[model samples]
Target chain A: MELNKDQATMSENNKPQDPDPRFACEGCSVLLDVNDGDRLVFARLSGGAILKIGNKNYSLKPMIGAPFGSLFQVESGDEGSFLSRILPVKQENKSNNVIDDSRDNRELVDNNEAQNLTGEEIEAMRREGAKGDEIIEALIANSKTFEKKFQLSQEKYLLKKQKKYAPKVLLRRPFARSICEAYFKKYPERIGFLRVDALSLLLTMANVTAYSDVLVVDMVGGLVTGAVAERLGGTGYVCNTYKGNSPSSVEMVRMFNFSDKVIKRIVQSSINELSSAKTVSPEENNQQERVCNAEININEPSTSDIVEETSVTAEAMVVDIVAPESKIIKAPKAGAKASKEAIEMWQENGFSSLIMAAQDQDPWSLAKDVLPLLSCSAPFAIYHQYLQPLATCMHNLQQGKMAINLQITEPWLREYQVLPSRTHPHMQMSSFGGYVLSGIRISTT
Target chain B: MLPTESKKAVSFKRYIEDGDLVIVYERHDVMKPVVVSEGDVLQNRFGVYKHSDWIGKPLGTKVFSNKGKFVYLLAPTPELWTLVLSHRTQILYIADISFVVMYLEVVPGCIVLESGTGSGSLSTSFARAVAPTGHVYSFDFHEQRAASAREDFEKTGISNLVTVEVRDIQGQGFPEKLSGLADSVFLDLPQPWLAVPSAAKMLKEDGVLCSFSPCIEQVQRTCEVLRSDFIEIRTFEVLLRTYEVKEVKVDTGNMIGESHDDYNGGLRPCKRKHRSKEDGAVSLDSSSNATSVVMARPCSEARGHTGYLTFARLQCLS
Candidate 1:
């Protein structure tokens, strides 16, 4: 135990040396936004990796050395289709009142014969290696009603045609904001419908910062754990405490592309282990710890395999982009057992903050046990899909005088379309982003 | 209130020593930041508390007053500081602040720039996000407000992480010394469009910029300017609806109507002697039917609107 403590301290003293996060490196996780969020995919960058887009598989090699936020467009060469990085040309400010031509959709008809070009001709143009812009121009010139439409509608038509013939993919660094958003959009149930704004609120209310021992009950996968570690930046511990013998799956942490130092800070411990009295002998404690690890080891292989498979299938189902499963050179594994020294420290001083996002579990039932693990006056936030449980939890905490400043807040996030002469809220917005119960723990004595 | 040293970490067992800052938490809504001094005595509605009594005690512990009333002395955090800080200007709350930090992707070792450091509310959290190695250069037009913000940062022990300056960013733009060095830039100005070109110049390739405005007109103008040199321009409005929880007595009555005599005999009314006969029977029936259950409802009053957050990423074009 003493040696382990020494090693942990020594590692803490060594500053983190992670790769520059601005550029997408090989083996790093990247979020691919297809055609301005028409589709989203999370892929690991490798030489052999392929992302299927609109019936063509594009090699991800071009994106490996490119800076994140670079735009890629599909191009056809003599050999095959490939993705080419395209630099955006500086455009003149055209966001002024250009829609004042006084043309409306009065004479627009939904007939299928608006264009003179056929599908075979467009295919033939593609075979001849014509650029996407050239093809769009040809299609526009052949359209019978293109000249009669309103300017805004014509622009909309051009955008629609561009999307079909010249789709652009944006390369993005996978941070907590993008990851939560991608999951919420594609697989909300997997993350308990915890929106990005809601996740941000949880971290803020909990006061997660560098060197804080943040405790989390992450039934919402590893979203919370990964987010806390990102803020900690390899400087603190984000311990995921669970209810039973086996630890909950935190496979989402892998998506953050965390460095080894940051991964080491992500550990897990059972609730019993955390709250148990430290009266047992060191040898007995060691035996219990070994048993815990064995149990976790038994569950690791199958769960990780499921995670890898789901990453591909998630994209396949959401956007029909059959992502080729590349060889996942395992990053340093997170969620190791909490060391004896660290657990002992937590039991002595308590965690700095607590964030709970347990699914289906009653908030009051969990808070009653977890509140004691937080230091007095330490802020804690609880997330629930329903309001009733969090409300019950807040009421009980107040009645028991276990905490102060108890408030249950639900986050409402609405996105807008900020365009010229047409700025309003998006037609479809998420009505519910879930609720959070936030408060500060107070000492009883 | 970030932990610059391992021993001073939030989870570390550090005692409340002299010359330390602590948040005197009286209630959820009422809090005050106090600097601990050896000869100081804090007098409140509870009573008088001597500074000597709080020394050597761990943070987050309760200290009693002369009348046996107690208040918790908590280690300060940016979240708590936001509540207790003096409002010099309309400040951004947690919802907007958190979203901006996350959306900008500001992490440790990232240089972030903010304009019109209003009351330094969001600046404190930004300092925390870019602590230990990174720095925040916050500019404000009001000289006195900027000085006061610097003092507040010193009080919070984050002056090392943040540099508060007096500069009208909208009028003069950011200082040229910071050109092409920032990882993120945040604008909370009246005419944020006036500063958009300068903000673009300050950000590195692929960096993010966010503009906050309370009115739709301001957002419209800002987005127009941002579209010239930015991509993925998005606008969002985030608000929090807080709920108030209480344990109230509710009656879970059955559908079938029952006779008054049946209720009168169901439960005993101990206070029957103090009430009339009919009143006693009715009170007894109500008591028998009512059960205490915890419930929650949205607080009738809340901040309905703060501001619309407009976020954009610098075009990746070299």
Candidate 2:
């Protein structure tokens, strides 16, 4: 029995270790990324009013859906864009005369033909299709002090009239980027000032690609998670480690019709599950402890064997912890096994990358809990709606033992409309795109 | 160090492999691609790093040199590759590349075409995202750049996913036989308007197209051509703002302060101490009420505007 045990140990020592697998891509389509037909569309008015045409909700899918913000009337069978125009509410028109606004104190024009005209006459002229510009011209001819006001006031008056007459343009495909802009226009508070420029920056900084194993905390609803999943296409895994158990408020993530495979790959585990996963059982720890104690051999054939032995021992402990952990984590049965294996592979290797974005969760705690899980050289990034919490996290991480090259950044997003004759950046844009703290994990020892 | 290159290969390994093009990450902004060969030796200030020693290790592995100095061995993901590649020419970075990929909707099994493969920076990403079943045809007028890009693909192990050809798409207009077969076409060439007509013709029904330009004049001209055959035209500029965040502990007794939102949880215990010496006029209450605050400032080195991505889809007929 003693001879047999010795032989087993010798052969086990001789066994060659395998290289871990890299991320792979398998055609994750874009339709699943945004146009899954479950998209949440908010109109550009009143805290993003839901745009519902009959029983059907429109999304940017199939590229042929009804445009957003176009005033649609339920016609006999079809909705026509050109046939509909929103009119000024009667209440507003009534209030316009009741309130003797100071703007009307200017001297009246002596054009008696216009002063003789009453409200009914103006209403008749409007109903009869008097061009807004022509009506404004007629009114201008009647007023004697039209040019007396300051430039800003005059511009404001023209803008009010323009808004009253202008038609709402139809927004097609209401994709994520457009949705962000729309939401920003309406309830900027709903999305936390997350702009398309900011979203793209997060995705880019995270190194999101097809077939990568990504871990994220998407507080901007599913914006961050969904965008990363879209980039992963279909082959890799993106595990969302959070602090709670219930469904996330990130409604946009559900809008994407991710495949069962993709959904399975997305493990919505609580932060406790991750924190517990980080803990190796004492028995397994003892086994690794024994493995570590054997590392003093000077006659080892090569450095490869020495490294391989310790890596394998560490890998075994990871497998022991990850198996039960994944059950609650609920990783995909197959592709997710790779994810667990990846975690096991990185047991001694370190983390591939880390991405953190949360509003309620403290950035410092989130980074601290997840930092040690990363490999020594893995890249990590933290996203916060405000910079204060992120700064605290950065400060805390700086004093730690595992991270290096820490820095926070805020991207300045500017847009320009390129046209034949008129080309310039939009006059107004949001000043805040949120802040990101990105750095690489390192081990000093 | 282990003989990482000469070891038994993992099953469908996702980690770094021997002979694979890996990026040696020295720092966040500093990296270089090195083909890890068995038995090869790399010299650095830290010490000698043996390529063979990295063989069986996973990607993102941190290894030590002879003097115990360390460096990260990372798989050359397209993004990392873009950062580490020799700057043969002006390159399309992650911001622009991601914008084009997404807006163009270049899925796997979808056929993608591009002109003037500048640094093969964008092609690497395309090849990986649309690998196994999809095809990426890249054309460059510069013969040497094309040849060099071809070699890069071969080295990166994505030659099968991408095809490199020497053709001035603006001058020759993508191969005639390829007309109406492309799912999407991306143009990075100057005078892209000269090729938009042909690109329009090459796209499949409802196929999307994107053009990257640095000037508004070029986009204006291109938009004119695109209007003839495309719809839903849009131009976007992706700006990246990065911030450096840190927490500071200050003496509230003598300091005027601004309060931001409070962080929900603490990563570490805050070392709070009540101010022993308090002035009656200034101290409204005990100084223990406040905690150290965190703040973030934009990194001075945050990259400014890279370029513009113009996207349009082919006009669809019911």
Candidate 3:
């Protein structure tokens, strides 16, 4: 690669370049310039074919091939190009520590400048971005001296321009801000509901479309509403009067109130306007109904208008209405009596009978004793305080309650035991048992 | 309860006393006392002491032997209670209690939750572990057995960290109030799987939970829960054995159980003697053999499972 470049550059020069000496062959004594225009061939004495090179046999057994002048080319026969020999170059040594005359060399250039132009005149030429050869040529043409100060000024100008326009590579993520902004916009309402329990459940339900805001309420709506508003980042309003003894009613009223407004804007307003039909007086209910009916003109309502009606009538009792697609889950208060009442209310409201066997304190001792009953199904939820009730539901389903379906929110049940027989004298052994059961059941279409 | 004196033959009052009761008498001259009763006898070279001499004597009073040797009697305390206790398993030793109590952090007012009411020895300590306001809930599936264990708790009068329940926790989670309420939970079960999640639920955030498993497989499964929900999971095994330490003279010649002469072959003469029928030797072989056989008889190794304790702490997420 080096030889080809040297030859290409030398061909463009007027002087003949030195021939490369590494290509010399050992078999025959010859100096071969492969780049010169000379054709030389050496054939073996017993070769079957005769050798030909540029129409002449330099030698039959060996060859010394060299060409003079810059335009020379080399060619050979099918035996291929061969070099016989070339001598190595020898270098002459000067005084080992000799220093060249630095002042005399400077004097020659100064005298030239003085005879042609002043030093200041030469310095002007150097400042005009002159190359080494250009500077030399300009000095000879104008007979001006080479000035270092002008050269330094021109170099500094070029360096400054290079620094100003140099391309810079910056490492940063350009879409970071936009991605974050888009995320915040998408979940502005949810960002505030990041409590420990809420976040845990949200993570568990990441695959779900969206999480419904769950509300647990009692008579103290102000306290619960205030807490919900602060913790969940939504307005919670107090509605006067108890809904019912049933947990489902409370759940339904909460759902009705939540779906009426966008969660984010609810924080700006008070929740005084939201009310369940159970909470309102009979006269007030009638007045609200009349107002709604008048505004919608429901007497001559269209099909869509009839579907949008809010009132839901069950067994001649007018309860608060629920949006068709909204979901509300209810849990009964802790204790047996409240749980039983809740279950009965749920059963009356079209929930299927999942488990209805009575369990008395001691059934054998008291026949026909009322036992705790559990009922559950889809579209209607029932909650209980104890695991036995839920277990009874599962047991009933296993025994073939086709209409009954139940969703268990709690994942596992734990039982603890302290075994007296094998415990250490000072260390008690408590046997703990846990069972994980699936409670969510989807109805088959 | 103070010591008092009685003029009685400490051993010769057999006729006046009940069966299985032995009496010792304090004699004036190793032979005679002021009174001697039936069903008791004073043991002496001269004759046996009668029950009449010792029957009414205060306990801990000095009683004389045939050769005028004095004997002292002591009343029993609960510390000696276990000596007569009927144990279903190898009872826990005191050596293990010191370590367990300190490590478990059982103290006053601690709501200690324990599962598997093994032998109630640990329960007794736990009762004492928390006193006054502290309470313990111990659960078991065997109702009949747990009732019996409750009787034992009543005897100890340490039922503070002790509540007995007869329910299988595998089918149900922890009681609602107990959920996230317990400060500590100890699990010792053949299969603790059903309790792990419930235990986690019952334990307050940052509460401590520990399980003792004899098997590596049990430890591995327990570690899975500890890693998933608990923080700072740790495992350790405790082994204890006793050594005898005694003072010995510095001089080689003064060493006991050592040989003085080369001909003695580093052996000492055995002081133990064999009893023969011709001599007045009473045979003790039958009783010794009976006890040896009973002691050597192996029961199931106490917690013969892999000995690994897996522990973790409930940690708050935020």
**Candidate 3 TM-score over all chains jointly:** 0.29
What are the DockQ scores of the candidates, in order?
0.47, 0.20, 0.01
Count of clashes, each model:
0, 30, 89
Number of backbone clashes in candidate 1: 0
TM-score-better candidate, 1 vs 2: 1
Shift of residue B36 alpha carbon in model 1, Å: 1.8
Model 2 DockQ, alpha carbons vs. true complex: 0.20
- Per residue, candidate 3 scores C-alpha lDDT tens digits across A1-445 of 3434543443344232332221111111121112111111111111111233333232212221121111111222245432122222222322222133232233334333333645686556445533333444444455333332243333343444222221111111111111112222232222221111221121121101011121122221122222222222122112111122221111112221122231231111101111223356888777555544443442232333224222211111222233232222221111112222322332232111111111121211111111111111111122222334433443333233222112222211111211112122224221211111122121212
Question: Which candidate tops DockQ?
Answer: 1
Show model 1 residue runs off by greater than 4 Å. Answer: A1-18, A281-314, A317-328, B254-286
Task: Report interface Cα RMSD per prediction.
Answer: 4.8, 10.3, 37.7
The sequence of per-residue lDDT tens digits that candidate 3 reaches over residues B104-214 is 444445687887776665555555445445688887777876786787666544443479888676566457678877877888776666678899888765467778776
Local accuracy of candidate 1 as per-residue lDDT tens digits, B151-189: 999999999999998999999999999999999999999
Find the candidate with the highest TM-score and give its number. 1
Better model by DockQ, 2 or 3? 2
